[model samples]
Every structure is written in structure tokens, then in C-alpha cells.
Target: MAVLALDPHIAPPAIVLQVADRERPAAGGGRLLPSGFLSTSGSQIVDAGGRSVRIASIGWNGTDSPPGAVLAGLWQVSYRTVLDAIVAGGFNTVRIPWTDAGLDVPLNGYNDRLGWIHTSLNWDLVADPAPDANGRYRYVTTLQLFEKVVSYAGQIGLKVIFDHHTNEGTEQKNGLWFDLGPGSAGRDGGVKGRVTAETFKQNWVRIARTFAGNPTVIGFDLHNEPNGEKGLITWGGGGPTDIKAMCETVGAAIQSVNRDALIICPGPFFYAPPPAASGMDPGFATPSGNLTAAGTNPVKLPIANKLVYTVHEYPDEVSDIARFDLAQSGAAYVDRMNRGWGYLVRDNIAPVWIGEMGSSLRTQADRDWAATLIGYMSGDYGNQGGPTFGPGQQPISGSWWLIGPSNDPPYGIQTEWGIGNFRSEQRDITDRMLMR
Candidate 1:
């Protein structure tokens, strides 16, 4: 019962009409997921059959670019090949990030941006071309490209989570989720100049409706890293600017369209002092401004048994490895997780996913930190190689930061895209996560 979000500016494809007419898999070759619908049940994501499911996931970060440009182009691979490699690497879930501008704008309007890439890059390398009726242009609209990718993901037995990574096509520096004007500093000017909260809600409503009843399309990651200096990040009671209120508004809207939709709410960013260089208290410092903290008066969304809380962790940005060295012990890292999003899971309030966390593993310290963190997440404290966090409660699940095939790797899992080859760091992290 998935609905198609067709751009009004373009002629409707026959495939879209076919999708709109069917209650089951449409004739466009997209298949239904075997695992069925996923819902949350007491800190665990349960499948339609009521079995607990842990997300062993990887992020595909292509939508960070302008409309119609995907990361697969950068690697000279097709979206299918990229996803095939992900499944081959033992990942069951893929987090695909997208910009609001890319999703909202019509295909015809994005021709110039697509043209620049078409001229700049080797055209033969681009994949998933949505040529015109007569096969004149080989470019695909952003929505069409996404649809193909999600269809392929389902065909390969991989779950997909659509992440709204940025409001604009450029880097996601604007802290606020809504009220972003065109030509705003740090945003690549295109499409609508002003993005209102209502627009954001409408966009998500369209998304939820489009993907509704598609079991493989799991959830909506509301926003990526709600951090900025404009005070857009608040847990509750900050008025309309509050993250909690926004999630409630948007989550309710999505649920209104599809009640089974799982809503992922990311924790707000706050500065934390580096752990003590040397002292009895060598643990990581407590973050000062976390909105997810129990003390912050967190709000409970209207959606029942479908809320998944998330927190992003980076070795340098979120946690200072130099100050809180993993070599010392896992106590500091464990304590830090407990105070942050972990408390939600510990208190049986909600399921918390370490939505994003990774590093280059360039140095021995970086390697140690990664190992220790993975070990801790897998309930193996201090790299003891055994579950020690508790009996039934560990952080519910986690997804690696990225799945790129960068030559000079910082946080990529593979060394080459579409080759299905994984770096040692990727192997170590995935292996540890599977233990849970």
C-alpha cells in the first residue's frame, strides 16, 4: 500500500500509476520485504512476528550532495552494486541520508545542478539513469533514484532508513530544522528560499505516505545532528524551536499518515569538557547540554511503542580520546554512555541507538578506542570479550557512521566501492556489533 510522491511538474510515469493502483507489490519489479513491519517493544525492535531485531547497519552518504547527485557516482558504481556489497559485508540495514532541497525540488528544476555534474564528471560512470520517454537524457530525478535504491535494498533483503541529513543541498551547518531561507549563509541556494516548519512537516508527510506499508523501508531519522548556535536544539519547553516539540509535531504527522511508522529522534548536541588528562577520575567528562538527559524534562511523543532515541558519537568531536583513553579501562566510556542516551535504555524509558560513531583508526590510540567502544557496546566491558554490561540490557542497537570506500580512510568500511572488499577496521567493528 505504498503511495508514490510524484512531482507535479513532470509527466506521471506509467509505473507510478501502476503503484497507485495496487495494494501489493507493483508491476515495477519492486518486491516486498520478508521480515515484514518492524515495531519497538521495550528497548528492542521487534519484527512482525514479534521476534527481537537488532540493526546491524551501515550508512550510505550520497544525499549530502545537490539534487540528483549521489555518492555512488563518486565511486563509479551503481546503487545496486553498492548495496550488493553492503549485503555481502553482512550488514542487514542501510541508512540513506538526503537533503530536504533534493527531495522537495522537481526534477526539471534541478537540471542545471545535474548538468554541472554531467559535464564535470565522466558520464559513463553514473548509474541509475531515468532517461526521458524517448531516451534523450540519461539523468534520473532524485526521487526516482531513491525509489530504485529502496527497491533494490528490499530485493537484496536489506532494510532501509531514510535519513533527512540536511535542509539544504550543501553542508548541514544550519542548526535549525525549519525556517531556513534561500541564500542563507552555509546553504547552497536553490529551489525554495524559505523552508518553514509546515513545509518540513508536509515533506515528511509525503515521505511517510510514499513509503507506507513498505516493510523494508523501516523508519524516518527525523534530522541529522540538531546542533547550531541559534538554539534550535532543545529537549522540551523551549517553545516551537524545541527539538522534542518538533519531533512530536513531525512524528505525529507521519504517524497520522501511517500509524506503524517508527520515528527516530536524535539527541541534541552539547559541549563536553575533555576527560581529565590524569587523575582518579579519568573517565570521560559529562556533556553539559544534552537534551536527552532525564533531568532535562524530556517529552514523550504521542506515538506509542514506536519511538527510537538516537545519539551520535565521534572519537574527536563527541569524545576526546586523549583525555579519556580506552587503554585505561571501559569504566569512563561506560559511565559516559549511561549519563547520555544510555540512561533512557537503562531506565526502560526508550530504546537508544548509537545512530552514528566511527573513526579512521589511523593510530594505535584510535584503534584501541574503537575496539574498546565496540566491546563496551557489545556488553564486553574493558575488552574482556564477554557480556558484562547486564543480563538483558545493552544499548539496543547501533549503526556505523559510514560505508564509503575511501583510499585514505578515516571512517570508511571498504577500501573500494562495489568491490565488496572491507578494511580491517570495518571487519573488527562489524564483527563486534554482530556479537550483540
Candidate 2:
């Protein structure tokens, strides 16, 4: 219907660009690109045509988890193959977790690992990785690598949600949306990885601009698992550390550039059931994945129906999952779910996406927790208002924690570092969960 501008200066890798420029469809003269532009409609995320779009995704982690600072499985598997596995696994989207660690590594560029490819797998990732004759390097920068991944995924009919997992390649060394070095948290410092609020927003803006109007790049999971000792990542405090404030600020900035991108703001770790009345307070730490403040102070974005609140539920040994006895559907558990972020869905406030959820499934408790979570989230109990989308809307959507080779139970979707074989045991759970 309407024209959307994908980055005019830069485009997907040459090989995939041909695929993206295929018979794009919308209406009238036809869409310049795929018609995946998304927006919110009363707690539902809908595609350009206004049909509900469920984000059934699988996380392809490692870029932000550290050690490699690149997408995992590339050491042995091509990203295309990985995408094939994801599609076969029945996921419509891929949650690409990344960091700012390499973004400024290049002297004149962002992300030293530009247009990256495994040297063994593709010619693009040359051993030297240095630009040659026409200032064009045989190797791609990491950002370019990311772009190429998105381009190909879109070609094969998959959406992507870029999750800013950590400040650096390592992890969330600090709870805030920043990483600090010995000196300041204000400027760029790779030594200790300085990522201030300002820099965080700046990095996000850069990313948003990079993929501004590409419909394949559906949403932005702003940050992952906001938690800290005292109250470093509390929301609605109206202060800098307030995660709600951060989401609003960053989301506004993103919509400013790409108004169509869905801004996913997850619940920070500070769970507590909200007070029944204004007189009551849910106190500090409870079992729920916290978004208590938002029960009153919702994340207001520059664009309406574009804010989707999210949560990462591990249920066992993660956060206060045990504290609430969530596996058994305890009262405390349901309450926390409501006050935390569930109300957003039930009250028709905003859509809620479980940004992350996984387990080793080693213990009976683990399996139970996972079952309970997906069941509640999937509207198995539509009468209780656990989570239920509107008519023509998809079931409460989410991404399986990962297609992994991780040690933290790894969200194991594949066996050999995510390249060997499918971890069907784990996928059995996901197949039931996401393949609705």
C-alpha cells in the first residue's frame, strides 16, 4: 500500500538482495518489499494487512553471550542452515541476540566484525578481513554480518527480533542497560566496556536506523533480564536507572526513525504482586518477574500499539520462580503474573511477549514449570485471564529461549553446538508450545 524505506545507503548482502527484491506484494502498485510491517491493535501485534502476527521464534544466541562475539554454530554451521533448522523446528521468527561490544571496534566503523562470515564457510569472512582495492573488504563487518543474516532469513520467510542482550560480548555484567569500566560509564571504553544510558540509547538508535523499514526485522527486544542487587533496574522510579523510563526513551527514539518497529520492553527483576488497593504495596522482591510499576505506570511509547511488554521466565533456579511455586499454579504465582506483566494482556493494555523462557528439562520440576508457563501463557485458562489475545489475534506469543549449544541447559534445540543434530527432546516441548 505505502512505501517503506529500508536503508538506502546500505542494503542486504548482494546474494540475498536479489531474493529480497523479488515479487514484493501489498496492494495497488504493490509493496516495494515484503508486506510484514507490524503494529499493535489492543494487545495484539498485527501485520501490515492487520491480521494477527504471532512471534513464534527461537533464539540464535552467542553474539551477546561472549567468547565468540558472533552468532553461534557458524564455527560449524552456516547461518542459512541454522535458519533452516529454525524453520523446520516450526518457528516463524528468530531472536537474534547481540551486543555493542564490537560495534566500535573498527577505527572508522562500528562492530569490528563487519559483514562477517566464518572464514572456513564463506569467502566473505576472509582470514585477513581487511578491505581491498575499492575500499571494499573481502570480509564483512559484524554489523554487515547481522544484516546479511536478516536478509536471508527474510528471503526464506522468517521474521527477526533483534534482542540487545548485553552491553558487551560478555554478558549483563551490570543490571542497568550499561557496562562500566574503571573510569566513566558515560563514554566508549572497550577496556571495561563502558555502556551508559546515553550510549545504550545511541547504540539502539544506530541499530534501529540500520534496519529501519525492513519488514523482516519485526521487533526490537530492547534489553534482556534487567536485574541488580538493590534496585539498579527498577521501573517507574522516574530516575535514570528506571527500566520503564529507559524503554520509553529508547522506544521513542526507535519509533522516531522506524515508526513500524514493535518496541518490546521486558520486565526487570523485582517481582511483586501489586497492592489490591492504592493503599497496599507489593514490597520489593517476590516470585514474579517484575513489572509492578507498570501496573500503574505503563510504558508509553511515541507510537501507540507499538509497545509490547515482555518477560524472561526460567521458573527454576532463575529469579524467584521457586518462591512463587509457579509450577503448581500457586496463588502467589498467578498474582505475580498478573501484577508483573500479565495484566497488560488481560486488561487490553498492551501485548505481552515472553521474550525468553527455557530449561534443561532435567528435573520433573523443570518440565512442570515449563508446562505451566506455556499453558498459562497460551490461554489454556482463558477464563482466568492468565493471558488471552482478542478475536483474530494470536495466542500470547513468545520465543523459545534458544537453539542452543549453551551450558545453562542451553535452550538446546540442536545437539552439536547447535550444528550437530536436532534436540528433539527439547523441541517436543517447543513444538507443543510455539507451533500453534
Give the top-scoring candidate (lDDT).
2
Write the residue-wise lDDT of candidate 1 on 1-436 in tens digits.
0112233244344323322222332111222234777777766666777666677677877666676555543324445556666666666778888777788343332234332232112233223234456533344556666776778677757788888876666655556676444323423234344566777788889888988888778888898876533334445554655677778889998998877767988766545332232111222333322434433354456767788877776665335534643322356656666665565655556666767776777776667667766766665543432233444433357777678664433547877755356777667666666413
Best TM-score among the predictions, by candidate number = 2
**Per-model TM-score on C-alpha atoms:** 0.75, 0.79
**What's the alpha carbon RMSD for model 2?**
8.0
Please give the CA lDDT of all the candidate structures. 0.59, 0.64
TM-score, prediction 1: 0.75
Candidate 2 residue-wise lDDT, 1-436, digit = tens: 1012223333336335334323232111211223567788877777777877677777887567442355766655457767756665667788887777765342122134422333334333332444445444333456777787888777767778898877766546455677653223543234365667778788889989999878889889998877634345555656676677778999999888888788998776654443333222456443345665666678898687788888877766444455653443444556556666787777777888888777767677777777777777777655555776555767778777778466665446666643236675677677665534
Model 2 CA lDDT for position 136: 41
